[model samples]
Target: MIRALALAVALACPGTALAQAGLDALDRRSELLGWEAVGRLDMPHGTCTATLIAADVVLTAAHCLHGLDADAPVRFRAGLSHGRAVSERQLAGWVMPERYRTDRGALERTESVGLDVALGRLDAPISTTDADPFLVLTDEARGDALSVVSYGRGRLDAPSRQGTCRIRQRFTHEVLGFDCDVTFGSSGAPVFARQGRRMRILSVVSAGDGVRAFGPRVAGRIAPLQAALDRDVPAPASTTGIKRLRVGEGRAGASGARFVRPERSP
Candidate 1:
């Protein structure tokens, strides 16, 4: 249900550009060195940002897999930059939230946003030297310093990171709001909680309105995804075409609007 948004909002934001907001383009080897765990998820239907949380597992947005056939194969390109990747692997299978549906309007619904996550099993494990997976912070603690690294629309070949961002609102009903500079192709991107130089994945990007970015709280979302993966099955034989949406093609519609339940104020 998430779609690409005009860069207008992001451009007019604070009367400056994203680079001025600590959004650094990780185009250099030195810049991308420690963040090889983040990757670009290539699916038959579309592409979304993804993160390597385990040697053989990845986390991404459920909408990225919309209409994906059971037998369709996808790929994960870790630390993709300038048409190169630190590592690449094929998906063996994937598991998403049971409540998620690809119904006509389901993706635009708030429920979809809260459960807009999936975990995919890679065909083979990636070596630590190529990429070291990041740890997930499974708690509802909204840290003041939060950041996001994503291969959004214009930067698909060059992932960028916003080193200084924060949660504008806390998690409510598994949904959290943040002030990150996200765009199309950013779905499944990882939001990280920073502690000095150490970072833990805090959430996965689902969608973003011009006002605020939205994603699952992630604290309680990972376990269910992992459990589903634990009982993983092989891809079934099917004839459905693997449709892949180009970068920034996940928009809900012409307008970038998606439903978000109004969390009551404290």
Candidate 2:
């Protein structure tokens, strides 16, 4: 499931050193503007990135919650850095595209990429904190550069911010291909485009196949998902059993997390 295109381009670029250097760890909560809203979602199966889009609403990948126990607990650690987090909240509920399926084969389809978005409600609101939720951009990114902040396997202790990355291609109205550097634990990470002093979320990291990481574009999927979340639609029940695997196991590092279809009961 690992792709080498983005890696190869990252390595071949003369600015690779500078780009790597720009991926600074958000160790200090006050160092960046939007770092506080982005956090790590720790699941029983694994970890993935998450961002607060509203005081009580979090945006992440639908697949991140797939296969989890119906009553399994999830922790949202905001602005986590070096074992310290600015805020922590329990997930109350979540909503996803009605068309999303947890089966391994279905999740691998290109169409599934757009449907892989989800919105989670936090048990408590964090509006009082310095962390502010980001606005979703309805317009497509026409800018030359975008930014991403995420936590991955090797960099699990703190969130890292890639100050700038390019959109390699806009595969469709729903699917976006980016050259952003990401890995296991980076799913659900936000891809942002700056507007003046503020930044808007353009997409959430979903998966990477070869050299490009892709996600559901904000305009097409997120808008509808947000509407569903606002209307209190229940998330589709997970039909598959959790496929827990050891860290560094097969395809585990392909994205932020990976799951296999469980055998059915006789």
Candidate 3:
């Protein structure tokens, strides 16, 4: 059997300290991950992390919205380095698969193995100030070495009100494997990598125990989702009014690699 190991790339906070921590930890694995905006869905139970896939779009776990109906207000926070952010965004709409429900047993099995994905369209294009350049996605046939990042209260709270992540696991794609260091609040962090000059996102961290487990698999199923994102979803015009940022001078080489510089506001 093809032993596929799913990698869970975590989301990050966007302050000087968080950025520095990410940069420091990223130097060795820069090609595998980048800084992303992960927000919680805000429910009585808990919260979930989210990542930006498009200009005004975020990709999170469907379970995050499972408890609420379609009309529920979906709030999001980017740059999650400090305990929270003052400049978070509120979404206009939240969409997920119709099959999902707020039940217990179904949620557990469906969360890790099923298509537990969700999408949110922001009220406007999220400012680059809070979010940053986009990350890429990995194909099914690619190798299985991933890096996860997160900003939340860990077992010890080393970062202190900032984001912290560790190398969770290492396995193949056809069969997934993980170290299970992630927890409930860590859900929705993007799993990605950089091949040559492209930042390819493979899977989003869904769920696992506190020890060692696999992340949600994302190989053959992502095609339809990618199609939906590219063809069906619409994004607002850029604040800069340009297709892409120039990043003219001070910014490092554009190898689609994740780098750390002074944080800026949108």
Candidate 4:
């Protein structure tokens, strides 16, 4: 079943072949059991990766939904592989820290890391059997070897796993730097730490500035955010939408990943 799904994905998304070869594909339900909650968010503006930290809540990067109408629609496809998925849900509301600003200049500042995180509330609760939500690791994640599974550009058909990335720097208590391989559409992807048989979410992929990837540490921010989300009601609609520039259409640094698509023969 897993191989069939993988073959289906490979055929549907021919562009992902080269990149997929280097990363492990969570092709079967069994292979995806640990990460079934991690999925892709298809926003009106663009696509960003996301993960379920709670059955009704999703964690992603604030910038992924920045500067759009507050009433836009964002669809979450859980455990998406090829044309199949474990489940799907439409978000009802979302919240980002007040400190996380989306102004063009904000990305350059170190303080921006503190505001990069965001949480979305689902309209309905998802079944645990489809995908189990991950627990947030409250401790600082310095010098730890981590893994990232993301639905990046080109490889959007299925999630790809980079099972052995490392945290190279801890900029502050709130921010950590990693040597993970990420690209456009990878924004909001979870950086995970495997503990025994369980996987815990440590941080979220925020930016890949061509050198290293940066994610907001989950240490102190998660509890409060989770509390706020619990009390917060669903918004009438989502007003924000992401505007994405296609590869080679403009300079790529601002968008996150600078990936080169393979050439095709007619």
Candidate 5:
């Protein structure tokens, strides 16, 4: 989502003049149907788009957790459109590939985009009735037609659906080059491909300008991501269940929303 971070790769090759499919702002409930799995990740600094990959797992861009040094929980606003959300939960733990990095110099590398993915283990699983998770299409890359639903900088409150996009080519073996209307806050947004009668997840938006964006090809890469998450699972309960019920839960004003000026996205 950081143009400065992604521009290094976007300028290397001219993108295919793919056909347009208009980015429709989903401000109404009717337009937001079937997109319940897509949610807004509210971090301490900013926000990013995320998708529910499983009952208790969420997939997102690792760069979105730039300021987070540990595997701490973060707030997830599920199915958020306009001012409200269908459900809200905390991401209890996060995991990233060994190759993922947040260093300024490292992020400038070509392979950084491929390693820009992370999985968050939710503290509580979202019920299937509330939102059904999308399956990852790991076996093939032949599908060309693509689409996206995301919360972007301009329409942070409402999600936009770009019903059509094209996979130009693989910028790198691990990165898929896509011509979509991507922007800040679109990071971690799932790029979906129609497989059979269902939509399958192909990649997570890593970086690119609005005209052309890049996502890491997820095939053969998710196993390691899951393995890392498995290793990080806490051994057992080490303390009591005591918790503060009202800490930082006060009536906050609009200033609490700090996702503005999102150039800081890694």
Candidate 6:
């Protein structure tokens, strides 16, 4: 979800500070992204980060799964760090509204009606130890703070092996705002809110600066999309004793793929 905002840049450029925050987030938090199977059409696998909304459900940006066919194997990795892992769950099903399609413009416009959000039902459960699900949006949260965390190798002020970033902003029923800075790999990262000991999900990463712009419109685009998700996913089934071990720590050697660690931002 992308929106046009005032072009005035902030006087205090926190590009470096903001980048550090992103890095810190990756190291310390359990952020999940929407990943796809790469390589073969049948063997597709890739990774994106997202927020756990239900015991077995994740909220992410719809574009992350846009080109993905219906039968694609979608996975969500929560509490991901340095490719070491935390939890891995295969998606039983995915839902994206019909409105999330591209509008084919230089300044892309996405609608919460469809393209701004997506929901996934995990094949298994995730532990709440280092990883847990977040709460959903509420009316009181309409003008509160939010965070966007992601793993991508874009124009980060400082680079890290973990590849993470987070920007603080305020959310309205129709918009979320802060300094815009994100890249392609960040598509499905969660826009979250932490209250006391509980973290809630408000939106999924939609769009920010692509090539030449800053934040794009994402508010009106994702709200309706999220509403649709709530209707489809309902709630996740409770599963006790979900495994707390990371996936790639001991298995990457056998898998032959180099494990990448998620970086933390300040």
TM values, all candidates: 0.76, 0.75, 0.61, 0.76, 0.77, 0.57
Each candidate's number of clashing pairs is 11, 4, 22, 14, 0, 44
Q: In candidate 6, what are the lDDT values of residues 1-266, reduced to their tens digit?
A: 22332221121111111232233332432223321111000115444545565555566655556577666887665554555456667776677656444441232232231234566666766654434445454534543444455555442221122232234343333434444344445555555444443334545545443222122233344455556555765445555665322211222234222222332443
Model 3: per-residue lDDT, tens digit, 183-247?
44556555554445444455565545333434455544444555554454445545674233321
Residue 162 displacement in candidate 5 (angstroms): 0.3
Window of ten residues with lowest summed lDDT in model 6: 34-43
Error of 5 at 240 (Å): 22
Computed on alpha carbons, the lDDT of every model, listed in order, comes to 0.69, 0.68, 0.46, 0.68, 0.68, 0.43
Q: List the residue pairs that clash in candidate 5.
A: none
RMSD of 3: 8.8
lDDT of the structure predicted as candidate 4: 0.68
Off by over 4 Å in 2: 1-22, 102-104, 231-266
**lDDT score at residue 207, model 4, on the 0-100 scale:** 62
Shift in Å, residue 240, candidate 6 = 4.9
Q: In model 3, how large is the Cα lDDT of residue 23?
A: 21
lDDT of 4 by residue, 161-185 (tens): 8777788766643677777877777
Where in model 6 is the C-alpha error above 4 Å?
A: 1-25, 28-46, 101-115, 140-145, 154-173, 194-198, 210-266
The true-structure Cα RMSD of candidate 2 reads 14.0
Local error of candidate 1 at 214, Å? 0.6
lDDT of 1 by residue, 1-266 (tens): 22322232223211112222446788887778778989998876667888887777788887777567877989999999999999998988888877774452444445556777788887777765677677677555555777788987667798888776777764434667677888777888899885444577888877666656777776677777777786774332332332222111331343323221221232
lDDT for each residue of candidate 2 in 1-266, tens digit (9 for 90 to 100):
21332342233211111123346666664564456888999988788999877666788888888656656899899888888887898887787877674453444355566776788877766652445667677665785558888887678899887777888776533677787877778888999886555567888887774456777785566666666765773433222432322111222334322121221232
Worst 10-residue lDDT window, candidate 5: 257-266
